[model samples]
Target chain A: QQQVKQSPQSLIVQKGGIPIINCAYENTAFDYFPWYQQFPGKGPALLIAIRPDVSEKKEGRFTISFNKSAKQFSLHIMDSQPGDSATYFCAANPNNTDKLIFGTGTRLQVFP
Target chain B: IAGITQAPTSQILAAGRRMTLRCTQDMRHNAMYWYRQDLGLGLRLIHYSNTAGTTGKGEVPDGYSVSRANTDDFPLTLASAVPSQTSVYFCASSDSSTGFDTQYFGPGTRLTVL
Candidate 1:
């Protein structure tokens, strides 16, 4: 099983439109959730992260909606821009483990 | 300023030969990790070190060995290369805690074995 399952493997959204990527996990012990963005020919970089204590966290145009009970979390990009177009991955880790289990990945295309 | 440096950006190795991928971090982070990326699959941890002298296995550790003799370097060695070992390898470092620290990644090394 893909510990973290991401939907809409490929997405297309117009500039200024909201682009959302969803991920569902099965491990209840996972308390840390993070999102990473990778451009072609580059390694994955950290975008944002959330702990189980908070329901949501927002930083600039990016917001993470988290549901503790459902074992789910999502990344919402407001006013999506062309520069934001890249492969996004959602990952999770247990309370004590430093290793992260990543999702397959979502290729987002923001059209102008 | 080098955050993390990986040697041999790309390499081709013949099966049964030994090869080593080198990684170094100047940040002096206490923890370092190795991960492999493959098509259709996400990053999988290979090995890690919490400090200078300690090492541990991660998600996928087979056919690989790592040594952390000093704080600046962590190298992954493939005893015998094989076609199944072809993949891009990344080195990452974190400050201390798992939840509080963000891992910084290197440019990556692409290795192909045949």
Candidate 2:
């Protein structure tokens, strides 16, 4: 129940394309969902996040579409650039919990 | 300010050896976490501390231990390393005081056990 399953272990896209990454979880207690982007030799950084209270949240060119009933969420990168190429991870934190359960990760490569 | 810092960018250790990964955050966040990242496995929480002087075990805490002596430092220790323990470790911090859900991560420590 703690696992957050993510699909498309790896993805490739051309520049100016939109790349989507999906994640699902079995735990209904999770209230906070966040996506993290990690570059080579760097730590994961918060790209965008959304709560179950809202269906979607957008930040700049990154957006998080959340589905409460389906226990799923996804990250969509608009006009993806080569700089966006990195490992993306989706994480969930149960209500009032301090720890987050993260997905395995998806390696995205945006080619120019 | 250095958000979070970890020591020993990478290490190759022999099995059955003891090791400790150092973590420090200058953000003065009250909560800190330790996670291990392996290819196809993502990041797994090993331990966490909501505040100084208090700590808790996480999902993969069996082979590891953690200490939170102060707000800025949290260290993870391995009593006896094994080949399976090889992975990239990350330290993260969040400011629970303000109800901030964002976790700032460190660069990560890559450990290889043989």
Off by over 4 Å in 1: B97-99
lDDT at position A11, candidate 1 = 95
Model 2 residue B26 lDDT score: 97
Clashing pairs in 1: none
What is the per-residue lDDT of model 1 for residues A18-68, given as tens digits with 9 covering 90 to 100? 999999999548878999998877888999999889999999999999999
- Candidate achieving the largest lDDT: 2
Residue B63, model 2: Cα distance from true site in angstroms: 1.5
Best by DockQ: 2
Q: By DockQ thresholds, what CAPRI class is model 1? A: medium
Per-prediction DockQ scores?
0.67, 0.86
